[model samples]
Target chain A: MPVSVKNSQVVYDALKELGVGLISALPETWLVHLIRMADDDPDMILVRLAKEEEGVGVSMGAHLAGVKSAMLMQNHGFLASINGIVSGAQLFRIPLLMLISHRGHMGEADPWQTEGGMLTEHVLEALRIPFDHLDHPDTARHKIGEAQTLAHASDRPTALLLCRDLMWEAA
Target chain B: MRRLEALEAIYPRLSDCVVVTIMGAVAAELQSLGHRPGFFYLQHAMGLASSMGLGIALSRPDVPVVVLDGDGSLLMNLGGLTTMARYRPPNLTHLVFDNESLLSVGGFPTATSTGSDLAGVAAAAGIPYSVRVHELPTLTAEFDAALDADELRSIVAKTEAHYEPPAATSGFVTDLGLLENRFQFQRHLASL
Candidate 1:
């Protein structure tokens, strides 16, 4: 059987262990609970930027504030945020734990998401970012660790790709 | 024109400015130009360039922040324009590279060619200045013109988007533990 906890719970557990100091993101259905989980603790600073790009900037500021920061957003927002991702995050070696909503792939019924979905992998590749598909909850912690590690080691941006089952319930 | 020309033109011409762009071909090209960039997320979020730049720019009103974005990426966060428009950062200048495709991912068409007017939308949202640049000469000219505008300026350039694929990593960052240390050293201050 698959891991019984919600995808958000898995994320909260992973982040709780990692001790993510600060986080900024748009409220995502998949990661909302996880974000809240990370928030209850005083050490974790959770801020919602007006836009995904602002989240990236804030996470960088959070870095200044002396905390490991992360930004969680959707695939579409990820696309919109690439410039900052490339220029701001990667250039400055600002490591941000990017937890992205896996839309436009696998049972994707939305027509608008198809194009954005197809571009997701290649775009990450172009950024020279290594991404792991969270197909199973068993892989979630390790994947999150890997991304956070990269940010820590190289000061480069790392991504965590969480799909439907990993993040959401069957609606 | 590629993302390089845009950055080369913008970064060199201006001083004390914050420049941001997306990941992929453009990011590499900008790097090749010998400029130190800020947080470069992998090529996942697009429209966020300006949003991030805005955060930095707002905090440091003394400096100028320019967001070099692509059409598709700009489309990713449609609401960003409204925020930018509403906030109206006088030091913010957004230059979008309109390639009309997700060129970095696959040579697929973006909504830009079909039905999006990002500049128009920025204007509608209350950006003090907005225009479209179909060629470099015009873009360069516009960039020169907007420098003195003293308000939020949205300049859209119609350019061919190109990309050479990047190597794959199972995860983006190398060590999760380092983030704590990295954040500590810089303290988020690029200078001073």
Candidate 2:
């Protein structure tokens, strides 16, 4: 299935407004369009990572060097990066902005993704990482900017969860 | 060769490079040697020293960055090798101290002990320069050459496992916490 370029543009514009200079991501079906947009942008450095934890590491490093960076991945990848996020980003007080695709939500079709969907908010709460759910495309830019502000002010990782409704045109 | 011996030889040659040391003996020993604002001592992020160094190198192109990684830690994130190769940051040099064991966690043998060739893997992953050294002189010479060149380099130094003594308390102050250390390093970079 082809990605919705218009839907991806909403999130991409929000990222640019947030001034994210670098982005590290592990590709997911829902994030294909956004990832492609990031790769083509000359102002942004797009890093394709082998694992989600590496994205955390890269974002932390970029933060240390005064470059604002974000990590884009699925909720499953978010679970994979918990250790790195806690030890590296949280311990060092490095501010990282994460854009996670919210899968397995209420009407999720894939059984494999449902478990991760249900556990996403709980895990974020457990880690004490604040998050904003972007369920509507119109509010994405404002929510992303707010998340960036929170991340920088707290010197911690903050997340913007993109729901399938906001990411897919048909949905 | 022991890890400290290799460190001792290379310590004198370090200039204005930002050094990121992996957790465990590597971090403890580097802390014991000296405290520099340029040194980022990773406490518990086992496999991120190289990744962090890569970020610094990419963002700060004028500054040279070095990563002091252990074989165990490197093996945990072998994928990092490919990531480094892909970007091939000219200002970054990764040195893995291959003691073939997780010395900090009671000396359990790692993959390197079973004939895993990290330098070869790095070469195959597309890093421009990669070498393995087992002697102090060769290690120092190779490191010096890498430092002098403007290219991504990797060195796997075969080292023997040795216990790192705890930081002395009589006259030494305790190291800064992670947040403070990060701020201090950032301050140093800003000043530069």
Candidate 3:
């Protein structure tokens, strides 16, 4: 089938290895399988968010309860969640690990996503939320682990941009 | 009923649950009674207290989670009600204090002042238990029952749009900084 299915499993396994007991996400195209995986897992608590910003508060709650959690969303979702990221996570010093699908990048076909994709990194930079790219399946696990570790160690928000290179095969 | 009096009425019952309050008047008023490890004044995040309580409740189903929200904050995140209803964790209790205005920030009129019904929205959002209380006694009784119920609950408490300035200063400020409160709250959760 498609490589995204395998890569999604890799990402899901990495999250499990990191002891992510809860994951909050808003549905997105690239994240369908990841959200499905979280939903199917009996041991995982998957929270479906109405807005991506709510994930920040969810992660803060998880942190307060000493439970590891992650937020799965698209680049646009990240853009929508800036207020919570700054006011909630940053202000409260919560470790927020966000897995963002990098849509509208170099080969983006959807015109609607291009502007958000172009601005995603700059916004993350402006917010000072450290981020890394997951462009290859081979390195997905390692990168995810490193990001999670850094997030908790620094007690701040960090992000992983899941690139099209790993998540899709261009038609 | 007055907001502070309402908070005072319910403060005694909060010892067993983790209480998350919105920033501004709610947090300040709660702090005035005293600080506890279980109390997290979600400072600056105006509208996400319900979301935070949902996370805590989902993470620790053994512990009860209460969200003290305001009409202005709740209106800003109406989607939060739908999300909370979607999960409907048994241990989560959402208490919205509808003062009809943003009392902490200059008593600005909110949607509630113009005929918005928070309890109606919450009930329509599918929370199993949703009610509106206009008096302190009803609020206290409903709050106690909500904690005891084995289903998700939401209560919209209508209080006067009155602001009480502290004798010395604005109760809007907390003694502990944001980071310190977070650490202390986390430690307390860990202890339990």
Put down candidate 1 lDDT per residue, A51-146, tens digits, no spaces. Answer: 677677667645543456677888888997777777667766777788888788887777887898888989999998877787677888888888
Which window of ten consecutive residues has the lowest lDDT sum in model 1 chain A? A1-10
Identify the candidate with maximal TM-score. Answer: 3
CA-only RMSD, every prediction? 10.3, 2.0, 1.3
Better of 2 and 3 by lDDT: 3
Instruction: State the RMSD for candidate 1.
Output: 10.3
Tell me the whole-model lDDT of each prediction, alpha carbons only: 0.69, 0.86, 0.90
Q: After superposing candidate 3, which stretches have Cα over 4 Å from the reference?
A: A1-3, B167-171
lDDT of 1 by residue, B28-119 (tens): 56545553434332344456666665655555556566677778777877777776776576877888888888876676898887978888
DockQ of all candidate complexes: 0.14, 0.73, 0.87
**Order of models, best DockQ first:** 3, 2, 1
Measured on C-alpha atoms, candidate 2 has an lDDT of: 0.86
Candidates in order, interface RMSD in Å = 6.0, 1.0, 0.7
- Candidate 3, residues A73-169, lDDT tens digits: the string is 9999998899999999998888999999999899888999999999999999999989999999899999999999999899999999999988886
lDDT of 3 by residue, B166-191 (tens): 54434667566887888989998898
Q: Which residue runs does candidate 1 get wrong by more than 4 Å?
A: A1-171, B14-16, B37-43, B164-190
Sort every candidate by TM-score, greatest first: 3, 2, 1
